[model samples]
Target: MSQRYPHPSEPAPEPDSALLGVLAAVIVALIGGVVYGVVGGTFHVEISWAAVALGFFTGYVSGKAGGANPVLQAAAAVFSIGGVYLGELVIAALITSQDLNIALTEVFLSHSGLVGETWDLLFRDKFTVLFFALGAAGAVAGVRKGGAR
Candidate 1:
């Protein structure tokens, strides 16, 4: 057997720390949430592609960074779903307040229950509920496909 190259077997790259992965996913989720809110609100889109993309991106980031840890996977799903829902609530508030000429802060701060009401209203639709489940499933799929562990 002759040597074909200088280094035939290089070590695999180490996986990122779980903490770092989770943190990165969270940061990405925050940005995704903002984008989702803006686009969904502006166009009055109930079944927005942005929301699905956000979930997938969040899971992919977490999986690639964390290497398929159970906690990371679960967190990714939870955070992604929450992020999408939160985005919807924020957008609803912004639009309602803008239409009424009321400060967004005043509506949010003065009426915290409004958030729950908004959630109820938005999720009342069967399609919206289905989308949420789909979003979570997308997150898990992303994690499984992208993660090594």
Candidate 2:
């Protein structure tokens, strides 16, 4: 028998560890969230397709990494939700600073109790909650789809 190389059309190899999946999922979700926030804020829009796409990307990366288990899928969804929240908060700070004619640092970093204030601001808008839920649901669905693939 002779040894043979992998066919040119063969799919690429997958990572062997669940840890890789988790890490990739986290990185992807965070980056996606930041992008979503910047674009959303720049356009002065909320609750758009980008948010759902980020969620889906997060879960897909998680599942693609290691054939993610259910626990991993759930964790990815939670992370995706958090990522979206962080992104929204960042954009909110930018928009608020712009409106007040202040630097972003003044709005986000100059206050003594800024964290609590930001949290309050985040919760003040009911739509934030809806966006989070939507992202989370999309993440779960993406994970399921990734597993199927």
Candidate 3:
């Protein structure tokens, strides 16, 4: 297998030639989602999901944007985190009722098994599954030397 951690200057071998340049971004997003799951723990699915979504969007945008611009990718990443955390904070802050505040935290903490509770359903798990599938598809296509048709 090729060595992981290629040098900073060496351009990477394409993961999937069809998409051309989205491979690395997808990989990074998968990493971010997995990290979100690990750090979010089962109890804090929202936080974790938020993190994963942020990462996924960032990666997806980076891939489509072209030009290998790290700064744009980084900006996308920041927006993702902001989407999750700041979004939560804003919602919580908007709850003027003391009882509603407590209920919100409780409901959030309890969300997982329920259909729409944990962000993992939408964010972490879904994104991870998606990227893994995409990566595998890319790798297979790459192995066949199908870069951008």
Candidate 4:
């Protein structure tokens, strides 16, 4: 069988923008964080594996929107960490809301100090640290696998 290739006269596709990749990563991280939070809060259980999935989705979206680059990979890693942190914070807020019989937004926004303290306590766990590292690794792997070369 003969191999087919692009014509010599055809122009190469334009490279994706770094800004777009960053934006996509940020958006994915925020959404994934909320989802992680809702699942943990509703079930009153902490599923650490969700962190890895969140990181993978964030990196995959960023990589698909932007070409493979060192800066994008680094950004994906950082965003993954941020996503995990946000998830923890959200979980704290949700639990507080349930305990205090308050709205979730009120607990999250009005009781920032309490939420911060709870988040800190939760974040100090050894398993949380291990999962965080795993999340970062998943993000980098996703970027490498999904990005355009």
Candidate 5:
């Protein structure tokens, strides 16, 4: 059952599907990040724009593959952010030099010779996770109700 005169905003399917695609992109990014972190270590260049691109592309592709409604297809561009986080870890692991760079700040945390805990926060993986989550939210929201034209 398809609509012959589909509105620019309306797809043959529904909006929920679009939302789901966004969610899947985030999940994929998380998994990719985990894999890369476990194998490659945590040194990564920040290509946030790439993540956004991936999020949109993956979401769009996935939605199309699933035969999602057109409305959902638009969401695909937003949902693809999932690939960003996941790709980040995997990319980091694959590209890192496998050296001490990963925890440079942390390694020197204690030997500050009475220095402040500047390095302590540097070693945390918490930021990566948080960023990934943000990416997911941004990508998903961007697709579903993004202010994009």
Candidate 6:
């Protein structure tokens, strides 16, 4: 059997770095959080499933960028949690904005205490805790799957 050689014109693939993975995960977390918030706010209901997507995407991106590292996995999990929290805050801000007839940005920036309080109330739901756990699990699973590449 003859072994095939790579084309001379093709460049070698770069090695993944943990730093890159963490950075990518952070970016994904922020974007995912915003998207989750927007979707929940638009429908006037909190969609728990989006948290899973956010976690999975964050982990997948991190693993793909940084390879199979424990640090990356941990970072993915942490970021996923933060992302969910951020989404809740955004949702609260959006609801407040609509009810108070204020801008979303204004509510977020100027009335953070109100948003925080609302988030706390929302977080008290048992479903929220369950979804948060599911999101963390999804993130870890995604990291393992993506890192296998």
Clashes of 1: 0
Candidate 6 residue lDDT tens string, 1-149: 99978899886564579998899889998999899888887876667679899999999988998888778888898898888878877888888889889998899789988888877776658888776776777788878877765
> How close is each model in CA RMSD to the real structure?
4.3, 3.3, 13.4, 4.7, 9.9, 4.2
Descending-TM-score candidate ranking: 6, 4, 1, 2, 5, 3
TM-score, prediction 3: 0.31
Q: Put down candidate 3 lDDT per residue, 8-92, tens digits, no spaces.
A: 9998663332233344445444555444444443343345335545455545544453334434344444434433433333333
Colliding residue pairs in candidate 1: none
> What number of backbone clashes does candidate 5 have, counting pairs of residues 3 or more apart or in separate chains?
14
Runs in model 3 deviating more than 4 A are 1-45, 94-149
Stretches of model 5 off by over 4 angstroms after superposition: 1-44, 67-82, 95-126, 141-149
Candidate 6 residue spans exceeding 4 A from truth:
1-14
Q: Estimate each model's TM-score.
A: 0.78, 0.76, 0.31, 0.86, 0.37, 0.87
Q: How do the residues 4-120 of candidate 2 rate in per-residue lDDT, one tens digit apiece?
A: 878999975644466776887799888988888778668756654776788888888888775746765787788888788777766776677766788767877874255346546
lDDT of each: 0.74, 0.74, 0.41, 0.82, 0.44, 0.83
| Alpha-carbon deviation at 11 in model 3, angstroms | 17
Q: Give one clash count per candidate, in the order shown.
A: 0, 0, 2, 0, 14, 0
Tens digit of per-residue lDDT, candidate 1, span 1-88: 8875546576566585678668867887788877887777676565556777888888888888888677777787788887787777
lDDT per residue (tens digit) for residues 1-149 in model 5: 97678779774543344455546545654554454334433344544444554444454444533334445444443334444444543444333323324442443353332112321333226755555555555444444443222
Candidate scoring better on lDDT of 2 and 6:
6
Superposition error at 138 for model 5 (Å): 4.5
Q: Candidate 1, 131: how far from true, in Å?
A: 2.2
The better candidate by TM-score, 1 or 2, is 1
Model 2 worst lDDT window (10 residues): 111-120
